[model samples]
Each structure stands twice: as C-alpha cells, then as structure tokens.
Target: MITLLSVYVDLALGVVLAFLLLSLLVSGVNEAFVRLLAIRSKFLWAFLRDTLDGSDAQGRSWLPAGVRDVFAALPFARDPRPPHSDQPAPAEAATVPAQETKAQDAVTNLLYQRVREIDHPTRGRTSIANLPPGRFAGAVLEMAAAEEGGVDGLLAKLKSMGSPLHGHLKGVWESAQRDLDRFRQGVESWFDGEMHRLSMLYKRYVKWVLAALGLVVTLLFTMDGLEYGKTLLRDNAFRASVTAVTEAGPDAYDELRARCERSDPVPCITETLSQPALVKVFDHAIVSVSVPAEGDPAVHWNGAAWWDRLTTPSHWPGYLLTYVALMFGAPFWWDVLRRITGIRSRHHG
Candidate 1:
C-alpha cells in the first residue's frame, strides 16, 4: 500500500509534470499559430476602432482612412485577410484627403498609444492582462488629455460621432472643463466598475481558445491522467527516480517560470533536470495507456476506429480530465507542487 505522504507527493509531482507539458504545448501552439489565427488581435483592433473611432457623414468610421493600414504597420499587427485574397486593395477601398493625413496621423498615434498603454501598461515588458484596472483607466484618461485639444479634444472626438452617450458625455465634458481631476476620478470609477464584465469577456474568449489548443495538445502528447496516476501509485522506483530529478534544484520553479516568460525553450528543455525531466515522467507514466494507431475495426485493419479511440465509452474521459488539468496553467500547479513538497519535507524532518 502507498503511504499517505507518497500519495500527496505523487499527486503533486504529477500536477507539476502536467503543468510543464501544458506550458510547453501552449507556448508551442502560440508560436506556431497565434499570428496565423490572429483571432484575438483582430478582435482587439475591431474593439478599439468601434470604441474610439468616430463616425463620418455616411455613418462609417471617420477615424482616418489609413488607420487600419497604420495599425497593420505596427509590429505584431495581424492583417485579417488571407495572404493572397482576390479582394480589392486597401488603397482602392478607402481614400484619404491630403489635408486629413496630418490629422489622421495624430489621431491614429494617440489611439495606438492609448490602447497600447491601457492594454500593456508595462510598456510591452509584461503580459497585457497584468495591467490593473486603475492603471488601465489612468492610461486612457492621460492619453485622451494628451491629444490635440487635450480633454476637450477627446470629448469633441467622441461627441462628433453622435453616439447615444453623447448627451451624457457632453455634460461630463462640460463639468470636466471646470474640474478635470474629478471628471477623471468619476470615469475611473465607472471604468473600474465595468472591468469585471470586460475581464469576463476576455476570459470567455481565451477559455475557448485554450480549450481548443488543450484538446490538440492532449491528443498530440497522449496525456492520460487516470492511467498516469495509476502508474505513479504502482511504481515506487519510477516515482522516486522522477522526484529525485525534480527536487535536485532549489530554484527550479522560479527558473522555469523566468525562462518560460522569456520564451526560452532551449534552457527549459535541456539545461535542467526539471522541465524535460518532468515531461519524461509524464511520458513514462502514460506508457501503458494506448490509443489507436491505425484504423476502423469494421475494415478489419485495426484495434479500434480513430473515432472510437477518441470518443469510446472507456477512453475520452481520461483524456478530457488531462485537458482540463492543463487549463489550470503552470503557476497554479507550481504552487501546489511547492506546498506539497514543503509538507513532505516537514513530515520527514
């Protein structure tokens, strides 16, 4: 029988290994396909345009003709169109007035800077999600005030569009003329209050994206949580070997996180007996859990149909459990690993 401490240690180690595998898988997918998909980036661009761009006489966006082009010019900008579409060129679609070029440049730059600042408050040094609500609101207001006509310029730009909120905004702008700080504070308060909705929207989109990626990753790696757990519980020698490999380094988790942040996969894989070592444990753990290699049993070619391998009554549940665990991300599992390891050390000492 397995000792209680052994169960905790095994479970914790399994979580750690799962996290590393999922982390690598997420990074790999992002590197390979995020630019190609551009789902989030396109959504971000459209959301910014709709939120910030003013409407013209024809009820179309008046926020300069080359605004999209300008955005496309930025680093990491994603064009929503296919690489070789038969559609009309952007220049053929929208024409800008010569006089409006300067204004367009100003507005585009302001919007770009503001959105970038609000979305990535650490000046692109950190994850966009790390930007707090206060900093995000402050960045938006600061950028608005920094525009051509200052706060009034921003209010005028928004008012020019004649949005439904124009009347209320006009009153706010009028009051802001008298007390800008108070206006900013009120706007910040409102923005903060609505941030939960924004966060939920972001999470909803990202959750689906990650779920799709997680499914691909789970199948690609053949991760089987139930089988892996069973293997660890039954194999003392394998468990001790992997645990010794992982626990060799004191700063292993921190180092792994730092490297992951930098996207330095080389150091993560080969440098330590941590990331790759953890992955090896996972591989060995699931070795006995087999999936279909070839084809339909109906055709007499195989052990099981591919669909049966994926969705049969006995198989998919474990794979799905593995994918859900991957969705928890590395940091969460890393913390669990630390806590369980600490507990073991205390108990043994």
Candidate 2:
C-alpha cells in the first residue's frame, strides 16, 4: 500500500509541474500574438463607430444622448463586417479624417483630433486602443471651444446645432451657475463613466480571442498532454526526478517565465524543456529494446512527424487535454502546485 501510494503521489507531481510550465509558455505566446496584431486598437475602433455617429466612432451620437447611447452600443464592434453592420462604414473603415469638412461634422472632427493627440508609440497614432475621458473633455473645451469663442460661444453654437450633448452641458452650466471649472468637471465625469464601459467591452473580447489562440497553439505544437503524461508515468527514473523538482517548490516555474518572457512560441517551448532543472530529469540512460536508428532518440518533435500523429484519432484526446490544461493558465497551476507542495511537506514533517 505504501509503495503504491508513493508511486501515485510522484505521478501527480510530475503531471502538475509539466502543466504549470506549459501554461506559462503558451500564455507568453498568446500575449505576443495580441501585441503583433494590435487587436485592442481594432476593438476600440469598433467601439467609437458604434457609439458615436451611430455611424462613425464619432463623439456625436454618444455624447448627445449621454450614457444611453453608450449602453445602446453594447458589444457592436465584435463583427465589424459591412453589409451586416447596423450602420454603413464610410470609404475608409475607422479612419478619422484629419481635415474637417461639412460631411464630417463637429463631433467627428473632435474625435479625429483626439486620436491624433493620444496616439501611442506601440500601436502607433493611426489606430489607438486607449484614450482618457479627461483628455477628451479637455480637447473639446480647449480646441473646440477656443475656436468658437470660449464657453459662451461654444454654448451658443451648442444651442443652435440641436445636439443631445447640448442639453446635458447646458444643465451642468446652469446648475454650476456658469462656473467654468464646475462645468468642465461635470463633463469630465460624464466622459469618464462612458469610457469605462468601453474598457469592459474590450476586456471581454480579449478573453474570447485568447481562447482561440490557445487552441491554435496546441495544434501547431502537437502538444499531447495525455500521451506525454503516460510516457513519464511509465518511467520510474523520470517520475522520481520530476517529483523531486516539484517538491523543491516554484523555482522551476519562475525560472521558465523569466527565460521565455521575450521569446516567441517555439523558443519559449524549447527554453522550458531545456531548463537545467528539467533537463537533468530527462538525462537518463536509454533502456529501450528497439534501436531503429542506433542513436536516434525515441521522441523527436517535427512538423511533419507530429502532424501525422495529430491526425490520428487516438491522439485527439491528448490534443484536447493539452488545450484544456493550457487554458487553466500558469497562475492557476502555480497556486495549485504551491498548495500541493505544502500538503506534501506537512505530511512528511
């Protein structure tokens, strides 16, 4: 009974340690993919168009009707394909024209200028992922109002345009008894509230994209979790070595994450496997009976060889297992491994 229990415990430790390292490597790749594509900028562009002009990502329809317009837009940016869009896309999708024209209107002009002001180095000025409401309000009041003739002139223009924003701003101005600072503060608060809604929407989209990326990565690597675990289970030397590493604590996970932080998917994976701690676990004398290529290793990863294995029906479960394990994420497994190690330490103590 004691020997069997010892074997089971080591098997569990080896499997959990392997998964924790795999999740970190996969997560780094996912982040790199998101950065490379600038998906956040795409999401933001969708948000502006849906909320603004109800046409473009203009501040018009959104600002005029206030929070109701933002609430109405919801997650409209997910499927940005035209012919199906609630509102038709202009010639250039999400391109806020720099030059002001009668066709663009006041709100779009403001949005275009704001995009220029907040353009980040990483995503570039053309497509932006983030903009603060405070800066947005300041732009409207400073640039938009300066040209119009200060607060009074801008207010007079607002009264004539018949915009939804007109009523809200006027109420704030009147309630503040025409105090400039108070009015600006009120407008800033309004923009801040609405911007928060867009942030939440962006995050929800990111979660779904991560899931899709996770599946793609599993397929590309031909990562079969179930099969790998079975191989290690049968190897007493490997199981014992891995259990020792796992029992030693989280040093294995921390070291891998640091090494692979800047690496792409393939390198990230190789770095984890080549880690001194784990490499030592794999450095055992070969004991197999069959010697097809005298010195050729039993397990070698290649796109051609793995792709064939991936197509086999028996290997499908392994792919599914790897995908599910990666989705749990590195942080989740790290915590689980720590608690597990703690339990073992206490038991031995």
Candidate 3:
C-alpha cells in the first residue's frame, strides 16, 4: 500500500510539473513574438540601411539599379525593411533628361507647397529642427545627390530647391513612433496581466494535484491497514485457535449447557453466566489457557472469552500504534521527500 501510494503521488506530481512547464514555455514564446512584432519595423529599417547602402526610396525601388541589385551582388547584405507601397518609379527617373531634373525639382517643390497649404499649421514642425544644422543640411544634400548630381552640385542646387520634404517625413515618422510606443505599452501591460493569471492558475493546479495525491495516499494507508488485518487473521496461531474452537464447538456447547444446569454448583450458574458480569470471568479463563507459562502476566488474562480476550487492553496498544502508523506514515514521508527536493507547497485555501 505504501509503495502504491508513493508511485501514484509521484505520477501526479510529474503531471503537474509538466503542465506548469508547458504553460511557462507557451507564455515565453508568446511574449517573444509580441516583442518581435512591436519593434519589427524599426529593426527592419536599421537592417536595410546597414546592408543595402540605400535610402528608404532606393531600398524599396524595384528597378535594375535599385537596392535589389546591390543586395543581390553583396551576398552578406540582408534587407529587413517593411514592404512599402509608393516606391519611386526608377524606370521613369532613368529616362529623364539632365535639364528635366530641375523641372522635376520645381514640381516636387510645388507639391510640398500644396501639401503645406492643405495642412496649414501642422506642416513645418519636424525632427530635423532638433538636429544640428550642419548634419541636417548634410542629410538633405545626400538625399539630393542620390537622385542624380555629384555631392557638391547637389548641395549647391538644394539651396535653390526650397526646403526639402524631410519635415513632413519626420512628422509622419514621429507619429508612427508614438503609435508604436502606445502599442508597446499596451503589450507590456497585457503580458503582465497574463503572467499574473498564469501564476494564479499554476498555484490552483498545484493545489488540486497535491490534494489528489493526498487522497491517493490516504486510500493506500487504509488499504495497508486492511492488508495488515488480513495478515493477522491468517497467522497460524490465530487460524489454529479458530479451527480448534470450531471442531470442538458441539462438545463445548454441551459442557456449557451442563455447567449452566448445576446448582450451588456454581451458585445460580445459568443466571450468573448469562449476566454481563460473567463476561470478565470468561475472559480470565480464556487468557489462562492462551498464554505461555513463563510469559508476563500482562500478556494474557485468565478469565476472558473469545471477544473479551481479543479486546484486552494489554494487546490494544500495539494494534492502535500499527493503525496510526499505517494511517499517517506515508503522508509524512511524502512531505519530507517533497521538502528535500524543493517542491513548492500546494495551497488549499
């Protein structure tokens, strides 16, 4: 019974541990994917810039001389930018004349002016204003140079091309960043909530698992007691005693009947023997017959009947101790093992 209980409890504990581990792994994976999604665009931009040697437009272009060609040639390069919808029409740009570039710049300027007219106050505020003038101007010149001209000529021409469209682009970028921050904050809060819920569920599951294990142990202990009782009753001495009594039953009854009929002969023998007080006398008689000659007086009595002899106080302590040990010992050992192995305690309440 003890072995069965231990095996059952161990199996239950293993199941609970497996469940907790699986939950933790799933939670970890979910968190990782959420975090990855949160910064996917930013990381993508950085990767494209580092590997493709191109600006956003160039990186997204689908033309022969675009980032695709550069990335294809540089085997080490990896493009990570999110796919864009309005990449430059590099095929059209390649066909334009040198003189037409100035006209295209003028048209671009006109478009920006129209956009400013439409947006009014929200137009000019840009991240560029937060940058050093030298760096900001250099960035504008580099963008223009990537179009067609050499760096020096691009810088000279940009002075006459009105302010660049960086201000509008910066505004959009900042707005996107703000939205991303809000999204990340929400994701973090959700993760925290999920973690808390998982913790509570884990605790609940552990409690139920432990409770089941305890029940199993209790059942095993009860079974052990029953087995012990069976063994005791099956012992050679006990079986022999029962057999002898059964075989001598008729003679014993006749003897008892004759004794009951005697007068003065055991004064009111039938009445006295039939009374409850006679039980102790019978118990004494049985005890005297059962024990060894040199045995302790406490080991047996001299006047007990079968029932009284079995219920003697002298033998009761051992039975009580065995019963108590069977009922409580397995759980005690299980608890000790759990503690030694650093297993968490289950909370019932």
Candidate 4:
C-alpha cells in the first residue's frame, strides 16, 4: 500500500510537471507570435473600433461606426475607407473629409485621441489593456460635461453623433430618468459589460492561436504523450527528479532558464533551448544533426523533412495526444501540481 501510494504520487507529479512545462513552451511560442504580428494591439484596436465606431461588435471586435469612420483615422486600425478617411473627421459620419469643419469638434477629437492610444508605447495614453469601467465612464462623462450643456449637452451630442452609442445613452438617460448619479452608474455598468464580453472574445481568439502554435511545437519536440507518460512512470529516478523540481515552485523555471542561458556555450538548437543569448546577435539559427538514409527515429520530425513531418502516420497519434494535453494550459497544470505537492508534503510531514 505504501509503495503503491508513493508511485501514484510520483506519477501525478511527473505528469502534471510535464504538462505544465509543455504548456509554458506553447505560451512562449505564442508570445513570440503575438510580438511578431502585433496581435494584442490589433485586438485592442478592434475592441476600440467596435466601441467608438459602432461596428458589428461581435463580428468585427469589441468596438463601433459615421463613428465607424474613427477606425480609419486610427494609425493601427485601418478601416476600409478612402485615403482621406485616415484624417481626423467628425464621428457623426464615415464620409467626413479632412477639410470638414467638424474636425474642430472637441468631443470627436478627444474620443479619437483616446481610441488611438488604446494600446500605446508611451505613458499618459488611454490604455485599454487594463482600463477600468469607472475610468471610461468618467472620461465619457467629462467629455459630455465639458460641452456647453454638461451631461445634457453630451446626450445631445451623442444623439446628433448618430451611432449605436446614441441608443445606449438614450437607454441610460431614460433608465436614470431623474438622477445624474444613476446615469453615471448605468454608464459604468454598460462599460463593464462591454469590457467583459471583449475579454471573452479575446480569450477565444487566444485559445485558437495558442492551439495552432502548440501543435506545431509538439511535433517539433516529438513529444509523445503515451511515450512520455510510460517513460516517466517506469523511470523512478526521473520521476523523483521531476517531483523534486515540481515542489520547488515557480522559481525553479527562472533558475533553470537562467542556468541554461549562462552555462550554454554553444549557440545550437540541437544543443540548447531557451536561447536568449544567441537570439540577441543572430537573425536566425541553423542547426544540423546526423541522420541515416532510412531516417533516424530519434530525431524530431526526421531531419527537417517537411513532407515527412506533415504526412507521417505514426507521429500523428503522439502529436495529437500531447497537443491535447497542452491545450489545458499552463495555469491549470500549475495549480494541479501545486495542490498535489501540498498534499504529499502534508502526508510526509
């Protein structure tokens, strides 16, 4: 019974640790993808365009539209309009030209400025990354209140602006009916709900992208789920080492990565991973490994044969199984590993 329990504990620890590491690898690749493509900025821009321009919120992103023309003016978000549409124009319509007097509209200009900085490099810019509901609501209230009639002026402006915001404000205006505070509260709630939905949509997008990246990486590593599990279970020394590392907490990774980075003298892929130092100097890497004519079974994807990599039948099951494990994500595995380790500690203590 004691031996059985110990084996089970080791197995759980090994399995969870493997999954967590794999998930982290996928996330690392995804982070690279995001930076390379500017995915976060694109998503943030999409959300702002939905809110300000009143575009199809779900279909286009979390954003809006005449107000629709705002996306065109944004440097990062290029709406399918004329070249002149890239200039600041009145949010009232999509066709407003650069020469239009509506360019002087204070509210429209402010909103445009704010939306452009939705995700920015500089400070003092309106960042949607961690924008709170109160902040957005307050900005809206401030913009409206700054106008000639205060909130009433803002309401009139939104109504004249003629976008989905007009209807949204109208609903709040009636709902609040008499109290200004209620109107403010209603706007905050509305902003909160929209942000929540935006977050969900972004997560959905991230999930799909991560899965694609994870699959590619799994094949590259030849990470067979069944094979990995069997080896981990059978090798007591490997299991013990993994379990020890798992209990040591998040710092283990930082330490391991740091050590790997420093100790790695060779800038070779077939030699080292987490190649922080090499990537800094070189644009890319080219690592070669020995393989026979029949192809080395040990080598991942069999010596860079794209055709074999894509069409290999035996590799498919391993790739699928491991990829499925990775999709659960690092956070899930981290928590599981932590909890299981805690139980073991308590039992042993």
Candidate 5:
C-alpha cells in the first residue's frame, strides 16, 4: 500500500509538472498577448479614467462623453456601451486609423486634464508619459497654490477626485507646509514614489490575466486530476515506471521545468505533442477509466476516445484543481516536488 500510494503521489507530481510546463508556455503567450493587446496600458488608462474623472456617490461616472470615448477606444478596452445595442457598430470602427485617433485623443485629454490649471490651459496638450516627476510635482503645487484654500484645498479636491493618495498627500502637505522649500522637495519625491507605485499596480492586474489564461489552457488540455489519479492507482506496471522516474530525484523535475521555461509556446506545444514526457500517461488513464482491468486489451484503446473524456462533466472538479495549481507557476511546483520527495524518503527510512 505504501509503494502503491507513493506511485500515486509520483503520478500526481508528474501531472503537476506537466501543468506547470503548460503554464509557463501559457505565461509566455500571455506576456506576448498583453503586449499585442496592450492590456496593461489599457488597464492603467481605465484606472486613471475612473480616478481622475470623478464618479458620483452612487457610482455613476462623471467623466465627460469625450473622455469616456477615449477610454473605450483603447486596445481591448472594456466597452462602456450596453451589450444589447440596437445601433450597429460603425464600419470605420473596424479600421486601425480610427482606433489610433481615439488613442491619441485619450492621451491628449488625459494630459490636458492633469495640467490644464498649470501648464497647457489652451494649447491642446502634451504627453504626461514622459513628464519628469519633479515637473509634475511643480505643476500640482501650482494648481494647489491657485486654489482658494492652498494645499488643504488641493487635498480635499484630490480626495473628491478619488485619488488613492488623499490621506498620504494630506499628511505630507500638513507636515511640510511650515518649511516651504523643504515641502516642495518632499512633494516632488512623493510624486516620483507614487508614479513607481502606479506601475506596480498594473503588474498586479497581470496576475488576474494570467489566471484567466491558465483556466483556458487547463480546459483546452483537459487536465483532469481525478481521472489521472484513478488510473495511477489501478495500473501496476505504469505506477512502477512512474515511481522509478520519481526515485531518480529532483533532476527529472528540473529538466522538465527548464524545457518548458526556455521553449516558446508553438515549439513547446509541438514537442510535448510529438513526444509526451510521460508516454501513455493520459492514454492509460483514459483506457483504465473506460475499460475494466479484465476488459479485452485490444478494445481498451478503442474505448479511450478523446471526446468522451473531454466532455465528461465529472472531470470539471479535477480541471478546476489543475487550473488553480497552474497559477502558482513552474518554480512553485518544483519546490513542491522536492518536499514531497523528502517526505517520501523519510517515510521509507
């Protein structure tokens, strides 16, 4: 029973490694997709739109029609329009030029809104993307100074605008007001620090994108852990082979991880398909589930149809488990493999 259980554990480790590999490839694809789709930038723009252009207490957006148009025009931007629309989308909407114009308009409006009180009140606008944080600090201070209540007024306005820095900015403003020169420098530093924090905020959203992509990949591969486990428990020869592979130590898992990490998605998928790391792992699982151990050997392969397994609703729980596991990525699973091996070694000892 110990040996049998170890074999089952080893099989699970293999499945985990396999999922991790696919996840790495999925991650690579997701990174490229993010760039091609400009997902992060769009998310940032949407964030800015929600924060900079204030919303009502009831959550209705107070952003101007033009500003909302700018956000909607972003690459892979969430459509603000209702899903059920009577009017058809314009033909020009399909063209790249129209999208480019909307992107330009968004950039212009965003910068104009930021510095209208300080720098470009009339002239269309400049790109805030390249504006130095020191300069941005100067601009914000100028706006604050222009207000009736000085820094305190700016803090209240910022809070009303839904800016994340309301409390922090208020603290800094109150503490630094006594020493004006020192306060100016502090504000500049604060602006630079906040800008860095903004970039990190976009990175957090990327993890969500990875999770969504991982779920899609898990379903695509039909990686059902429950089905796999059932077969691993039943097949004596297969279990022995997998257990021997695991007994070879950490190097085996590391090699699989390295293969997935270094390879591109197309090549990774191709190589995995051509020569699956575990020969007949899935095939045996499918066969075992479809045919009794005593069933005719030749007909077992015929019974292991791909569609039959893919469509099985019973496999969903396992598929969800696989999806959740994939989010932890390859390195995490490598550590798990090592720990499992250590536990098994100690148990035998």
Candidate 6:
C-alpha cells in the first residue's frame, strides 16, 4: 500500500510539472510569431511598391515617353498622366471655377480615403495602380494584399512578439511603452483564465485518484484481518475443549476419538455435537477451559455470531461519500473540458 501511494504521488507531481511547461511553451511560441509579423510588415510594403512600379502604367510613367506610348496602345492600356492632370499646363490653365475645384478636391479626397482603408498596421494593401480594370478590382486588391506578404507579415509580427495574436497587437505595438504595458495586462488576463482551468482539473484528478487508492487499501486490510481471525480459532486449547465434552460412554468415546483424528475432523465433530445433550455438555466444558497465563483465550460459542462481526455502520458514511462524488464528477469534468477546448455538443434531449 505504501509503495502504491508513493508511486501515485510521483506520477501526480510529474503530470503537474508537464502541464506547466506545456503552457509556457505555447505562450512563448505565440509571442514570437507576433514580433516576426511586425518586421515582415515593413519589408512587405516596400516589396509591393516596387513590384507595382515595374508592372503598372501609372507607376511606369516615370519611364521614357517612347516606352509609355508603345505600351499605351495595348488593349488594356493605362494612362501615364495623373487622373485630371489633363486640365492644362499652369501657363495655359483656365481661370479657376469654384464648382470644378470642389469636384477635383472630392476626387483627390476619395483617393486618400481609399489608401487609408487598406493601410492596416499589420497588413497594408498592395497598390491598386497595377490592378486590371474591372468590377473585380476590389476583390483583386484584397487578394493581392494577401499575396503580397500581408498575411505573412501579420503572422511574422505575432511570432516576433512571442505572444498570441489578438485584435490589439497592432495599435499597442505602434504606441508608447505605456500602451505596451496595457497590452501585456490584457495578455496576462487571458493566461490567468487558462491557468485557473488547469488548476481545477488537476485538483479533480487528484481527488479521484486518492479515492480509488483509499478503496483498495480498505479492502486489503479487511481481508487480512479476516484471515488472521480464522488462524486464531484453530488453536490446541479450542480443539481440546471440543474433544473433552464429546467423550462419554465407551462406544461414544471410541467414535468421537476416531472423528477427532480424521483429516476432515471439524465436520464430523460438528454433526455429533449438534445433539441437544452433547451440545449442553460441550457448552459447559468450553466455558471452563483456559489458556496458559502468557497466551490468548480459546475461541468459544457466543450469542453474537460471525454475521454480527461482519456488519458495520461506518460503511454507510463511505458509501454515501462515494455516491456524492460519482454524481458530481462527470459534470465537473465535462464542464472543464468544454471550457478548455471551446467545444460544444448540441443535443435535443
């Protein structure tokens, strides 16, 4: 029993330590990805700009005029000039009109608004000047954004931070140290929730393990006690007391002596002793018999029987406790698994 208990204790300790290490590992990996994403974001934006300039007309207009004209006649040509730059050169420009200036301003503002829309701190969009003309431009822009290192950059930044990706990683990293501190607090809160759940599960496992061990120990001790009690009843003093009272007339004495020496002596003795006159004689003889001064007393027939010894009130308390544990144990484990794994099962019943 002691050896089993020690083994269980060691296993429980190892399990607890392993869980702690695993949690730390998960947290560290998540933060590292966040930081990597930040660095990747910077380089990704630069690459996208370069790629657009090499392929698109609005971007390629910086090239020689001959090259621009050659590419302009293509089926899917792009205008090298800025949108609305066709008004005129400053010297030949017409006088300002209020309505026209307002309209131009609106167009310029719209362009700026579009730029802002795609400029996420973690995943900025690729330039639209290189995009093919179509109603699918918006979708193409998003796809290009994802392809041009946007998703990779975001993932890298998360890796670099050595933390999990949350909605607040971007603005918090961009801001001052104080903002970063606040972000850490939020991450800490998430970690705390995870830790709490793990602690609860560990406690529950310990309880069930202890309960099983306790049951085994109880059964072992009970069986051992019963065996020792049987040994005590077979002593010389108990056998002598049974033999003396059964000896009587010459015929009876010879028969009883023969039965006493047989290999299965107890059954033959018990049958002869059941006679009313023989039982009275044996009872009186058993009560008078005594062991030596240093030895324990011989076994005797008492009103209290073996069944009386076997029955105990203490068992009721243990059984009640086990029942309560069983009632709650399943639900408690189910709730813990649901909270930790974020899995829900739907059942109409």
| C-alpha TM-scores of all predictions | 0.50, 0.56, 0.17, 0.61, 0.47, 0.20
- The true-structure Cα RMSD of candidate 1 reads 14.8
Candidate 2, residues 1-349: lDDT per residue as tens digits? Answer: 9867876676677778877876777778767765665555545554554433244333333221333222234223232211111222222323222333322455444455544644534422244556677766765566434443566665565555443455666776787687778878887887787678767765555566567767876776666677666665555543344455468855545544444567763465544444433233322212212223247556433555555766888878988987898788888888889877784334653
Q: Write the per-residue lDDT of candidate 6 for residues 117-193, one digit (tens) a residue.
A: 33333223222222112212232223224333443443343344322231333433344243434544543454345
Writing each residue's lDDT as its tens digit, candidate 3 over 1-349 gives: 9745654555444333322332333344434633433222223223223222223334342111333333242222433322332332232222112232321333232222222222212122211101122332333333443556443333334334332333333343354463534433443444345345534543443344344343333232221223333333333233343344478765444433444455553344334334322122223333332322356545454342444534556645533433344333334545655664577787999
TM-score top scorer: 4
lDDT: which is higher, 1 or 4?
A: 4
- The C-alpha lDDT values of all candidates are 0.49, 0.55, 0.35, 0.56, 0.53, 0.35
- Rank the models by lDDT, top first: 4, 2, 5, 1, 3, 6
Per-candidate alpha-carbon RMSD to the true structure: 14.8, 13.3, 28.3, 12.2, 15.1, 29.6
> In lDDT terms, how accurate is model 1?
0.49
Per-residue CA lDDT of model 4 for 1-349, tens digit only, reads 9877887787778777767877898898878765654455545545654444444423443333223232233334543211112233234322222232221333333554433333344223332345578767766765665567666666666556544566777788789984779988998999899878867766776677687778776765666666556655545543344355579765445534443455642332224233222121111112224333365633232345544544668767866887898989998888899899774434653
Better of 4 and 6 by TM-score: 4
Selected candidate, larger TM-score, 3 vs 6 = 6
Candidate 6 residue 179 Cα shift, in angstroms, is: 1.6
Looking at candidate 6, what is the lDDT of residue 42? 23
Tell me the spans in candidate 5 whose CA falls farther than 4 Å from its real position: 1-9, 48-74, 77-172, 178-181, 188-208, 230-306, 327-331, 338-349
Candidate 2: where is the Cα deviation over 4 Å? 1-13, 49-54, 57-124, 143-179, 237-304, 341-349
TM-score of 6: 0.20
Give the per-residue lDDT of model 5 (tens digit) for 1-349. 9976876676776676666676776788877875555444444444444434433344544332342333244443342211122233222211111122222333224333444333321122221233456665665565566555766666665565445445666777677864656667887787677667766765565576677788777765677766656644445443343454479855445434444677773466445545433344444233432333355544344244655766788888988877888888867876777686664433653
